[model samples]
Target: MSTTDVSTNDIVGAPVATTVEDVLSRFSGGNREDLIPILQAVQNSTGHLSRESVLAVARHLNLPPSKVYGVATFYNQFRFQPLGKYHIQVCRGTACHVKGSAAVLESLKRILKVEEGQTTKDKLFSLEVVACIGACGLAPVISINGEFHAGVAPDRVAGILNVYRRRAKNG
Candidate 1:
């Protein structure tokens, strides 16, 4: 996958590499209390925390690697793998469920060939099921990289993914 895509939220400096190191340099690098913020920063800067980044953060904080892993796993907010270029978040809240989001979710899984939280092998897409996205009125909504798709039906999943696929290829 091309990391240089214009749609990707890469850091402003056009960091070709050293994303973890670059994010790490922003912190104090020694305080125990700085762990969560450090992890958040890394995730924000790179879409998710990589294993190398987790280890790097542990080393920077002077903590055991297991400690960092434990803290990260304990929270639902942290993800160790980088997200795909197009991250799809399908809302499965009460309203969305009633509106057939389960079928929508299933269609997404089948079409993308990845379960929830898994990225496509090409790194073009990732699937996530969110509890609520504050679009209940537009129940059965899915967000692709924060752009909302409202009133989605299972049949529309392929068209939506095709649009992103075409965008990636054309870019």
Candidate 2:
């Protein structure tokens, strides 16, 4: 949502196997407004949008690659990089901030040994900060793979990380 442009490094490179032809075939080649659906389908197929997929879309939709990339970059929900198996989203909203969310963020960053928007070396977890999760009443919340942990303190972070680590180890 910032005016600053996201760098290509923000999007890890991975080849996309699913083509626009495949998407069009599935949709029966109706309207061009189907571009969004086409892109989403490619993303769902590849787990992330690879450079090849972008080019394929450009060719199929008769748009330039730059425009396609522009649209992809405009949306926050679309991920260019391959996400970790476990995605961790930490709330840093106003209410959370008032309740010491910074401490929780620091704890998570330390435990994961990765800065915000980076995935761990093991590819087990990716850390990200969200404005709010509407759990402000609980404040200082952390969501691991969509499961919310509220009222989290620095002390509790290690245990939570340990739980994920153990699960990873087992699997």
Candidate 3:
């Protein structure tokens, strides 16, 4: 089924019958081993693990909702909230911190009006502060949808965000 056939209410409240059915049909076994893969598949398609989807998975696997939630939460890969079109990852490693990444992060938070790990109200941006991104030489770095912006300064935050905003509007 197409994404258009699925409603936002269904995604957030209860799993759509068609969507859940379609996702379940992909797997063959009811063994516990199927749990991670099933969750991964659902998250892959839906972008995040919604409560409804988790419940549907629990029912399908004859497991408890708590178990599903426990596993999902244990893993860093799973996300409950819907991500914005632009996902921003700010480096907070030692090198980044020493190079003013904190200021850059503050700038992001101020300009986006969202705390770390939160999405903007407009669904245009999501902010995440990571411990490290393996770009020590490029300390004070921020990545927008995986495109690294090295040596980011607080003053440049608006201009950088504007580039993405313009892209969204133009596209």
TM-score of each: 0.82, 0.69, 0.74
lDDT-superior candidate, 1 or 2 = 1
Q: Pairing residues by index, what is the TM-score of model 1?
A: 0.82
Model 2, C-alpha of 75: deviation from truth (Å): 2.3
Instruction: Please give the CA lDDT of all the candidate structures.
Output: 0.80, 0.74, 0.78
Per-residue error for 27 in candidate 1, Å, reads 2.1
Q: Per-residue lDDT for 70-95 in model 1, tens only?
A: 99988765666568888888889999
Prediction 1 global C-alpha lDDT:
0.80
Q: Tens digits of per-residue lDDT for model 3 on 75-158?
A: 755667767888888889999999999999989998889887678999998777777878899988888877899989899999
Off by over 4 Å in 2: 1-33
* Best candidate, TM-score: 1
In what order do the candidates fall by lDDT, top score first?
Answer: 1, 3, 2
Root-mean-square deviation of each candidate, in angstroms?
6.0, 7.4, 7.4
Better of 1 and 3 by lDDT: 1
lDDT tens digits, residue span 1-171, model 2: 122122221232232455546765675554567667666776655656778888888777787899889998787546665567777888889999999999999988887898876778888887777788788888888888777888999899999988988998999
